[model samples]
Target: MAFIFESDLKAFLFCLLQFVIAIVVSYSFSNYTNPEQRKLEKVAMLELKVEQTEKDIEQLRDLTRSLEGKYQNIESVHVPLVAFHVYNPLHTNLEVGQVIVYQTVPLNEGNGYDRKTGIFTTPVTGLYQFSAHICNQDNAMFVYAIVLEGETIALSTQRDMPSSCNTVNALTVASAGQQVSVQGVHMSKSYQVIENPHRKNSFNGVLLHRT
Candidate 1:
């Protein structure tokens, strides 16, 4: 009976060893069959990302070129101002007291659009104020505005503002080396004196200081 019990215990031990060995072999085989598959997937994903980045870079380059072209066009641009035949005596469009018709510099001496003459060429670059004023003997003078480019009316305004004995209207023009003119039938009187020609409205409208 003792021999039989020893034999049974040895068989059981042997069976347990076989089971563990089988499990280990199965696990190792599974890993070895597809060892490099995960690495290959990672490589493919990296390649896709790199391709997308290249496309993005190409698109950005195109956009940059387009913007550069537009900037070049803007740099070459020149804003044209309207001109009239001041020498023509038959020009009925000339109004009384219009400075463009007579004044050397048609720009207002007050830094305002008070002086509406022909186009005044810009001497320097920056912000410029334009203003106009009108007074009627009947106390019902209406003020109008038309901004022109050469012969084209870029803007016009019929908005009548209240006026004193000498009504005034004004606007600002940006940049330099452009032309400006009055676009109405009525005329305006210029200021008597200018203080600082360099500074806007420093004395009035005269650009006296060297830019």
Candidate 2:
């Protein structure tokens, strides 16, 4: 009886050892067999993480600037006084020489932009940067001109289907009360058409350096 019991225990121990060996072999085949592939995957993942981190940092910086513009008075620091962001949800139809008016004004520091006139008048003499974004309706095309002091500095166009949006930015020197706006160009050409209401067509400006 004692011999039979010992024989049964040895058989059980042998089976256990075989099971452990099989598990270890399977693990090695899945992981260690393709070391280069695993290394490449790790590298790709790291690069993607780094790229996303950079974008997050940039977005945070932009938010910080926007917040500073919101809370701080223009005179609080000598940094800058003129800054604004405005968008339009009205007046999609347009004609030649018509100015684009953005009715909504979210950030207007130093009272530089007029939501009524669709123009930005500088509050302080400095170098200014202006941006205009246009969105065309599904079956139309619209062209816009970024006018600084009544001179076209930049132009952009958007079409109905394939390309539905475009943007134009301008950098110019101006003084207090100098006008900056977007206008129709008669096709140089430009004529405004109905714009997509779902898209936010925008005009924004910022004072870069004080002269």
Candidate 3:
């Protein structure tokens, strides 16, 4: 009976050793495979984050370019544009309803005034102020008008006097390529001379505001 009891105790010891070995192998395999799987999942998450960041950066660049283009367009359209002043130093004769061609320019800011043609062409759509001063050398009645786009806008009539002067001023809006000039008319049936040796006979224009 003792020998049988010893044999039963030895069989119990063998079974306990087998159970311990199986538990250790299972723990070791689980530890190695779990970390590798976690690393693969982390790498995939990082790749997705990087792709999303790249797309965000590209969208920002496109938005910046669009804003810059709009800013440039605004800058180009609203700048201050046209101004001119011209005078005639020599004495000149004029017939009735004739355009006075002022042949000298002292201040032509935008080069819109033509000294040869005696015309100011507007460079942009804006309100402008134009002024003309005329001095009659011959003691006779004369009338002068500020001509804008082939129509009179302002007129000044001087009575018969020695060295009489008349000034006409007009404030009007003009479009691009519109013309402005000064026209003179003699009340009598004779020509009139403008004596302006001191550069008194003058025409001036300036841009007031853009439309």
> lDDT per residue, candidate 3, 107-149, as tens digits?
8888888877788898888889999988765666778889888
Which numbered prediction scores highest in lDDT against the true structure? 3
Evaluate residue 193 in candidate 3 and report its C-alpha lDDT on the 0 to 100 scale: 50
Lowest summed-lDDT stretch of 10 residues in model 2? Answer: 186-195
Any runs in candidate 2 off by more than 4 Å, and if so which? 1-77, 160-163, 187-198
TM-score of 1: 0.30
In model 1, which regions exceed 4 Å deviation? 1-7, 30-34, 78-211
22-139 in candidate 2: lDDT tens per residue?
9999998878768978889999999999999999999999999998887765544365667899886457667877887888888999887777788888887888888888876664
Backbone clash numbers for all candidates listed: 19, 2, 0
Comparing 1 and 2 by TM-score, which wins? Answer: 2
Report the backbone clash tally of model 1: 19
lDDT value for model 1: 0.43
- State the weakest 10-residue window (summed lDDT) of model 3: 188-197
